[model samples]
Target chain A: MRCPETDNQELLVAYGAGRLGSRETAKLEAHLAECEACRVACAAQATVWKALDGWEAEPLASDFDARLLARIASEEQPGWRRRWREWLRAVAARPAVPAFAALFMVVAGFWLLPRGAPPEPRADAALVREIEIIEATLDDLEMVKELSGGDRGEGARSL
Target chain B: MKTGVQQTVVGVAALEHDAQLMLRVREGDQASFGLLLEKYRAPVVHFLYRMVQNQAVAEELAQEVFLRVYRSRTSYEPAARFTTWLFRIATHLALNWLRDGKHERLQERLDEEGEGQTVRRDVPDRRPSAEQILLKRVRRDEIRAAIAALPAKQRAAVLMHKYQEMDYAQIAGALGCSESAVKSLLFRAYETLRARLRRLA
Candidate 1:
């Protein structure tokens, strides 16, 4: 059949394979009614396919199962350590893993690391001075408290 | 591990046994995982061998495909046929491997020491003479190169259709597209192959 402009060689191949539905089949049949060249071409293609049916499938190679089974066995780990080892191997194989680990470390450092002492020497000195000033002020207040009311005598305090 | 008795797979027994093995795989049984590989290795390797045109690469990729299934075993749901899922994973890895360019494939091959095994495999030579074998190899190589040169989706569609005998619907699932898309992809693939291999005919 003379295929339409939209109907290209693929349809011809599909039609040759008997894959077209009834409507398409009817259209092809009607087209073939008028067109001899396409009909011949289709016949030739179909014949080639029929001839190909005599061709046997290539035999699968030996050791295919043994090798594949060995691979699958290696993946199914016997324990957590083996699984972790596999993960390390996989990560080492791909460049993406170390980058991901680095990013993970960065993110974890920002979020989870302990909030501890400031590191600057000036800040440390300031903190020590601040503690001393606060201590002096507390001493003055305690002296005032002693003068105002509470027991101050060493013997009474001890008792 | 099961000792001393790997069962031979045949007929409907082979098909039914695949599902049973898949069930064991889901429950973390290593022997069942081995059985799945034992049963499907040839067809799977053949499929990849045709797709990639490099027998050694195909063999390595075939192993990776099964290993992928084993690793994903915990998430394996028996909603569909195991072979279907297996092939879908195979198609996905192949296409993605292609898409990821040359870099992703470095690790998925035989080690440098085993590169000796990658020497050109001798296909069955039924041709008349050594010269005829050379000519046939040239022709087969050309056809394979043409098929591989096809756009990834179309090449995959052609492979699934030709070797796996998957209908359009199954291909749609495997390729993650609609059935009509599968049809269109296959149609395009066939057209490409016909154009490339026309001289060989």
Candidate 2:
């Protein structure tokens, strides 16, 4: 008779938990009857399971409910501020949000930062200066025209 | 089996109820929120306590868990069981706490004889002699320590499996892993447990 392989821990765990299919369980059982090592392995796993049965977590204190309620009240007090922080944290924890935010900030900084030494001056101030320069030039032209002749219209007519 | 299908249908109905409770919670029903907290507080605390092996830390984390649930109430989705959602939050916190090395000092503190002394007092004094009581305490401590020694994912797997009585599907949903991954986790976890607790067996 060919002995079945018993080295599969998954099968053993399922067998121990009685979760294995009937055919698999039967085969493991047949192997277990004949194999000392597999049997010992199963027994050890079984013992671990048995020992775990006694391990119950201690009951919460009687005031646990009250304490939790108190916590809920405290959390509700500052409400929106806490909510914002939680939202911020959740958003920050997302892989793409922070990356996108960082990329945006960097692009924004590059776009807004002065490319060279601060702008020569305000554009409005430059415009005002140019207007003053044009006014002065016109005033100079008038003076030249007066210096050239008192009646430029008469001069043009004579020409 | 027909019964299995019936059980699935029942489970879905129960989950719908939980979802409705969450919906009420979203609607600013304080009582509904409190009801949820009351229902899940012990199980969450117990699961965390087992994960961290420190009651204070466990309780603190449990509070954070519920606080998170409340904080996220507005965005609550009824896609899964509330318990599954709750545990996923919890398991994330515990894993982070462990990763931050916060538990290392606590584990050391637990290792000291004095700390174990207090844990022993919590036990009802049933043993006839001090030695038997001491022995039993040590054995229990050993089991806890062995469990804590497993990697965080494996430990979470085993805790959900053994304590929560959650099957592979539930655990996978909670841990956000495949069912096969959960099986591997449990297999490795129990393998370590078997190795560590062999003498006891």
Candidate 3:
């Protein structure tokens, strides 16, 4: 049988919870009497409420009040200090910002150095090559002087 | 003018009741605050425990509930029932905590503490044998898990309805939803519980 509005499970919940008005309850009761389907549904709803009656919350700890008071005391510190701590906590909780920041610092550190102290001007490859050539030419000139002086000294000794 | 006078009379009467204690609390009366704590601590803790499904977290949240109340005492308005206001704070906190999903390990604590826990003598029991006790506990645990498995709003609706015995209006007030919405939450919640727990029921 199709469930009527008055006898549906949802209305039965209200009826069970004493939420329905007297007129509504009377209508639901009348419908329940005629419809076995709604009756079973209502009974199931009752059982659900019955099963809920089985669970009980455990008692609070003995020092609950004391601890609560202590927490309040700790929270009652200077407003600026508390806000600062909260700010720090919020920043620490976000990983993406800090991770990006560290990466940026590392990249910027490499990018901002003074380019290895401007590459020492005298250390150029072309200048080193020119100095080596000059040294070779001077050594050739010294060799020529020594050979010519030896020939002149031999002539004088023969005379 | 008549409605205003009636409201003023009602407000006065409410002040004579719990609101008076809160007013004293606002005035820095520690004893009044203690009295209020003594009265509401258990119910609030129980509500929080059922909401979070964890004992330690429930107690912590309950403590936070009272702390929030104390902190906001200066602004406490007696326009609504004090319980309504209290549960409003509570439901807000519990919902936020659930949304955050801060501590999954706390659920382990709930299981450990709740398993085989003794049923209160207040529950009408015709059979008082060891087997009966074990059966009742197992059944209770199953039901607890079933209710906890509900969505946060549904669980809050059920807790307020079944445990706190709150009417639809009060549940709506605490949940900041319409009465029809509260009914819908409870309806869907019971439907799911009935499906999962039909055998126990």
Candidate 4:
């Protein structure tokens, strides 16, 4: 094995486990010839491989298959039927895009229906104009009172 | 009757004679689901118990996995090996349970308190006596403990390799990595196992 690195021992161990490619193995073999350490590494790796085969799985519990299948059976369903129904539901779910858009616009417009329009003149502006007219009338009355002061007795009776 | 179709049915039948009830669960069959529990209640419960190292959490999580399997029944495919799939699900749940960081190991010692106080024997002088069996069990336990000591990836690689007889490719799928990575995982796992088993050797 052409060893790629001193670290190739670990990789060689992996190689022995069938993990490494042939090129990697060839490289490791090349290293093994040149490096005594790698040979020892391969040997050390051999012991573990031997033990690994003897590591049997624990016995399955007596009822393992029974329960596992029961679960599968309970979960069984008609493959195509479910798919078909789902397909139909999907087809039924669609509405034309423009129809949907129109519906949405209608709902939005209903919510946004405008408030009552303001009059031509606002209430505050009308109030200010009325105040100006009243002030002019008060001035006019004051002028008339001054002019009529000489004839106050007869005018007062009429007034 | 010996036609391939007949054989297929027979195969599926033999597979389910014990757990046919579980088959019903996929069909939303509650009765079949109940029968499944009747058949597999112990194994499922104990498997989780061993997996999580906690009886209560195992029981709870086992129930959840079952519910999940039940919920996802419509997509169930029978083409694959059932035990592998089931254990895959179980393994995933157990791994998630371990996200809390090896609760099962700590709990195992606490639960077995006063039991392993002595230097347990794993191998005997070979006459195959009662002592030999006891020793064998102890050895197995030690090996198991060593296996448990490995990092999660190595432990899974080893367990899947050993217990599941999965090829490195299948392990790669379960591990969500490349086949080469799985090989490295197994190699590291073996290195650890060898070191631990050497004293017993």
Candidate 5:
């Protein structure tokens, strides 16, 4: 029989834990009888297991359940402010929300502008043409006044 | 018939019951959540206490574990045993706490409290002599120190293996590792413990 320590160490652990079946236990016992090293290893593991068994956990605090339930209740009924903040955070986490917001802003800007507002260059050209037209009209009025001024000049002189 | 198979069947049935309760919680059944909490609260606290070696921190972490369970109830699936999922949450929190190096200062406080609690708990019924109590305390301290000295993963593996009585597969599920890795961890951990505590036998 091979040494369990080398071939199958988990067997030693299971054996020490009393988890091995009767057949495997008998087999390991035979190996332990012939092998001093396996014997030492098994004994040591069993001792370690026993020492661990002595380390019992302390009793839980009596108010553990009460405290946990209270926390859960508080979580379930967070203040409106906190809920609002959480809602904002959840909204902020989604890529689509911000993207949609930006697109909406762009669309809104286009929609809110005056329908008849002209382009900047076209408005500048129109203003220049109006100024030229006013200048040309003023020249025509000056020419008419000159053409009628000689007779009026003579009449005023006579008066 | 194998005992392992029998235990697996039993474990599955128990987990199925827990899953049913959790499903009810998903549907807003507060009473079902309470039932699950009442059933698992002690084991979770005890496991965390053993892992962190501090009572206060263990209780705090246990609260977080349950809170997470409740918060995630909406997505609860019965793909795995509830114990596996619960312990996985627990083991993750404990490992994080240890990794953060928060346990160093608390260990001294634990030393002070742990001795008193152990003595008080033992004194009630058995009424062992003073010398015997002192001896037992010494042995218990040695065991705890030996376990604490192990690497965090190894410590978790050994605790689940020995105290929690979890088989390797369950431990692997909780630890998020393969069964072979868990076996290796236990092998190394037990080897270290035996070296430190062999004289106690």
Candidate 6:
């Protein structure tokens, strides 16, 4: 067999892994007897493989399945609030979404406003009108009191 | 010859069975999902633990992996073996976690808790001496360090190959690489491990 080092190292890997067929294994063993480089490389790999077996993973937590199931359940039943929050999060993640939303709000605000109608009076202007009406009513009351010919002092006091 | 053929048939049938279970899951079969979860939970978690060298993070990542499997059930297609799809999700999440550098932050905590948390499966039924226990712990730590020193992809390849016992084609499928690339990765990874771990052996 050609030296697996320069030829087909995959075979050496397979042999080290114990994955090669018996025929291939026999052929490789025959080659190993004559090849010092292959022997050293294979020995090192075999040692590494054996050492790796010493690191056994700790057993999983007891609640692993329960926790996973709960997560799935929560995801499956995303309440309206959660759904809304998720939707907002998804929208926020995309810059264009917020920009388009702001643009839409501006456009919709203009579109929805009453067209061809007079604008409502400002708060300050309405306040002035209210004050003028109150003063006019008071003047009219005083004039009525005078026309009734009550005592002047009494009329003034009443006004 | 006959046994070899029989084993191949059995393997193919098992793959089909996993796909069938997934198909049922896609069709709103909750029980099938439970079965699938039960089957793969330990392997997935253990693989993550080996990858991250942190048990808590591994379990969390494993949950995310299963959660993804559940989430993607709607669009499930058995284009490949079920294990391949499962590991692909796991490998992606793990790689992302490592890339995000969360492992570095957790490394200190893992070291603090390492002694209390790690179990020794090889311990004899009779109580072993403190020296034996300490020796085993040191050996295990060395092996883990050696594995952790490998590049992410190579580390993943080694974990899947050694612990998961996945063949080259299956690993390539999970890793989304060609078979030859997988071989190259395993080759380099083993080379590094041999150099670091030969003394232990």
Relative to the true structure, candidate 2 reaches a TM of: 0.66
lDDT of 5 by residue, A1-159 (tens): 445464467987899899999999998898788898888888888998889888898888999889888778767775995677668879989999999999999999899976885755658788999999999999999999997897799989999
lDDT of the candidates, in the order given: 0.70, 0.83, 0.84, 0.65, 0.87, 0.87
| lDDT for model 6 | 0.87
True contacts kept of each: 0.17, 0.54, 0.85, 0.15, 0.83, 0.88
Ranking 2 against 4 by lDDT, winner: 2
Q: Highest TM-score, which number?
A: 6
* Total backbone collisions, model 6: 0
Ranking by lDDT: 5, 6, 3, 2, 1, 4
The residue ranges of model 3 lying beyond 4 angstroms of the native Cα positions read: A5-10, A18-27, A73-159, B1-10, B14-16, B108-130
Task: Please state what fraction of the native interface contacts candidate 6 reproduces.
Answer: 0.88
Candidate 5: residue A58 lDDT (0-100): 84
How far out, in Å, is residue A138 in model 1?
A: 99
Per-residue lDDT tens digits of candidate 2, residues A1-159?
A: 222454577777777666779898887888789888888888988888877775678767777767767667656668787787668878899999988999999999999997877656568988999999999999999999888786777789999
- Cα deviation of A127, candidate 3, in Å: 99
What does candidate 1's lDDT look like per residue over B92-150, in tens digits?
A: 87776677775235535535546657456665656378687678667665765676688
TM-scores for chain A over all candidates: 0.38, 0.42, 0.45, 0.36, 0.46, 0.47
What 10-residue stretch in candidate 5 chain B is worst by lDDT?
A: B116-125
TM-score of chain B of 1: 0.76
Question: What lDDT score is found at residue A93 in candidate 3?
Answer: 83
In candidate 3, position B179 carries an lDDT of: 93
Better of 1 and 3 by DockQ: 3
What's the TM-score of each model vs. the native? 0.57, 0.66, 0.66, 0.45, 0.69, 0.70
lDDT of 2 at A144: 94
RMSD of model 3, in Å? 18.5
Candidate 1 DockQ category?
A: incorrect
- Clash count, predicted structure 2: 0
